[model samples]
Target: MNRVVRAAATVILLAILVPLLVLSSAAVGPAPRHWSGVSLSGWELPLVDARPRQEPGTVRAPHLDAVTDRLIARGDGGWQAVVPLHDGSVYVETTRLDPSLFAELGRDFGGDRVSVVYAPLAPQVSPDGGGGVPAQTLWQRTDPLVTWATLMFGFPWQLGAALLLTAVAYVVAARARRRRAAGTAAVPAG
Candidate 1:
């Protein structure tokens, strides 16, 4: 094969393989466990009541056993939660807490009752909860698949820059080719 064809083929192959590698690696570990009908203590209120939309909330275990950072979201008529573990792993869960449910529960019970389904992503750091290493924020630790997708599809600026560079290169090449042809035509036949 020609050099350009070989280079293009290599680029295409890498583009396909890179995402597959990232996704498959993300699925390597044990699946995350799910819990249902998790009861919330009134003291746990600080943990669950705060809205993830505004900012992250902090929760210390009722017995002061451990500290956890929590993020809660209630939008699109649904609810979601994210908690990062000490080992740089993350737990993501979602619940369907519609407005009607809230109205039925009223203000008192609304914050106490919930059903959660959670999964643990790969740990980015070792499991050393006792170590002095500070806990990582939700932003620092995220699922690999989510990270990969964001890098692949979310940045419009990168695509725009690439297109601009390609256009400039094409124009420069065209001008060079024209100059070469004109020079050759002006010379007398040997």
Candidate 2:
């Protein structure tokens, strides 16, 4: 390939590969095993609770050994519960629900019940939760093919590519040696 062409290709490849590997690595991990459910309650601050439409609620998990209470904040689309764990506090967001289900929860349950799933073994993204968990575990999110490819290849396409390049180089060197020997033999031992 031309020098400029090769460099451009390399840059483009790096751009795509870097993001893909990052996202894939981030995605690769087993989901949390334990989940806790809490109910949202009215806040003590009158202004906080009575923000017209914004009803800031507090979720208390007295049942959970790890957490006693959490201040659930109202987000744009959902609620974020800042639950304190053994390590630190984690912001758990409520998963999206059906429109009817949401409305029913709002009407009947006052949209109090919120399910927060978490992995005890895995690290959390919260600033207080130290850091995120490494993507070492094979049992991860869906897309078996992608996971398999990522495992087989490697980050930035290094490992498998190195092996392939080595094999190709060896083959080329062997062919050159054979050609040199054949030429020597044709010269009648001169």
Candidate 3:
């Protein structure tokens, strides 16, 4: 499309996507308190099953081997992972807690109403990753925001990157046009 068309489309699309951005960001980041981390150094002992300080809903998703996978699947359903990070910390990350479990907290869809449960698996460190924390996922909470962001805003943010690039292109074109006009005005017909 032409410059004006592309620019107009960019504005319209971004406007439509604003709320979506808020949602997905909420999904992956901090909106949900579902992700719980423990001090890896302090709990130096071997761990058994997930020792959840908090309890999640009965319905839960399966555990993925990696954080990235867990994050991607979080919104569809709750999940748990014990990531032993390189920083000597065992990050027990879990998501998609059933809101019903914490009804007193708020409604299932309410911003403050979700929960994730987790506990350290002893001997948290994988035998091989010697020095660094093995990146274990103890537990995580589901924030409406994270859930929304993951489910909604995620795709927009991905598109946002492309939209941003187009915007830059428009700006560059505008500048180039201005320079060309200025050059024309300065040149007396040779």
Residue by residue across 1-190, what tens digits does model 1's lDDT show?
6759856864555455444332232244222111121211111122333212112454422411121121212212122334443333323342222223233323322222332221223233322332544555444444444434432332233334444655576689779989999999999999
Model 2, global lDDT:
0.34
Candidate 2, residue 28: lDDT? 45
What TM-score does prediction 1 earn?
Answer: 0.30
RMSD in Å for all candidates: 16.2, 18.4, 14.5
Write one digit per residue (lDDT tens) for candidate 2, span 36-145: 12211112122222111222453444433222132212211222233433322232333221233233333432323322321212322333342443333323322344
Misplaced by over 4 Å in model 2 are: 30-190
Model 1, which residues run further than 4 Å from truth? 1-149
Q: How many residue-pair clashes does candidate 3 contain?
A: 39
TM-score of decoy 3 = 0.27
Tell me each candidate's TM-score.
Answer: 0.30, 0.24, 0.27
Which ranking of candidates, highest TM-score first? 1, 3, 2
Per-candidate local distance difference test? 0.34, 0.34, 0.38
- lDDT per residue as tens, model 3, 1-190: 5868976887766655653443344444443232121111111113333222323333232321333343333332233444333322223333433323223223322222122332223223322233533343444234544434333333334456556766787789889999999999999997
